[model samples]
Target: EAAVTQSPRNKVAVTGGKVTLSCNQTNNHNNMYWYRQDTGHGLRLIHYSYGAGSTEKGDIPDGYKASRPSQENFSLILELATPSQTSVYFCASGGLDRGTGGAQDTQYFGPGTRLLVL
Candidate 1:
């Protein structure tokens, strides 16, 4: 029942421009996350939100920002896009039911958006 979608499946950006990636989910989940996958760096968490109107910085928050306006929408903003930031970005939505003695978190991910910076 949980579905996540991303917009502008592919993007080409200049060295110093800005790029915004959009994501929408239908699960009404409480947590949303943004991640980037690269050759050497592997998959890294860039940003996340606990719920609507709340964005939290992840492990690799530099050069990236996140916005969650509603229960089903989240966006990632690259203020100054660079070549080093060129990679496949993915959005996921899910959360754990922490009240039950530590429930596992299972996130549903959206189709990735490939970005290339020149």
Candidate 2:
């Protein structure tokens, strides 16, 4: 299983400001994902990466940017933070299943980062 971690477990941002969330994985997983968890609503996809130097937009990519400079690191950037963006962010790492040679449905998740926008 991959070990995932996120920085600044808690944060307070102002509207129209910038906020950056960072994630790192110990295991060399080919896929990495960013998700946000909110009240009344479940988790929503923000962005994802297939491998180093590759990033893809997920279901909710607006007002956010993703960067995957290396296999072990991925970052989520909010150029203009908003109150609606206040939520708990999670990072997950997943790869193929050796047994089936198929994508692994089980992903290892980070502790999560909580952001409160003012």
Candidate 3:
């Protein structure tokens, strides 16, 4: 089973502070992703890694950076936290098999990490 978990399910940060969010997966999946979900908007990808030692910036990589030092762990770093960055972040893992035709690679998501900045 592919299982992903995130730390600090809730957080409160001051402006310009640093915040680090961690994620761990037991499924050993090749792809891991970090995303933020906000009301009236779809989940937006922040960062992703194909495997250990490889991290790539996603669509909304600004104000955030990512690290994947090992196969089981990935972290998201906010160097200068801002109230605009407040949102619920989710960690996810994608499996290789899509059941048929590889048309759908389902991404299993973690509960989420809600962050508030003030």
Question: Which candidate's lDDT is highest?
Answer: 2
The reply for model 2, stretches above 4 Å from the true place, is 97-102
Spell out the clash pairs found in candidate 1.
none
Candidate with maximal TM-score: 2
lDDT of 3 by residue, 6-99 (tens): 9999999999999999999987778889999999988999999989999999999999999999998999999999999999999998767544
Q: What is the lDDT of every predicted structure here?
A: 0.90, 0.93, 0.90
* Per-residue accuracy of model 1 over 1-118 as CA lDDT, tens digit each: 4689999899999999999999999877899999999888887999999999999999999999888999899999999999999999999998764444433377878999999999
Comparing 1 and 3 by TM-score, which wins? 3
RMSD of 2: 1.8
* Backbone clashes in model 1: 0
lDDT of 2 by residue, 21-92 (tens): 999999788899999999887999999999999999999999999999999999999999999999999999
Residue pairs clashing in model 3 are none
lDDT of 3: 0.90
List candidate 3 stretches off by more than 4 Å. Answer: 98-104
The TM-score between candidate 1 and the true structure equals 0.90
* TM-score, per-candidate, Cα-based: 0.90, 0.92, 0.92
With a 3 Å backbone cut-off (N, CA, C), the pairs that clash in candidate 2 are none
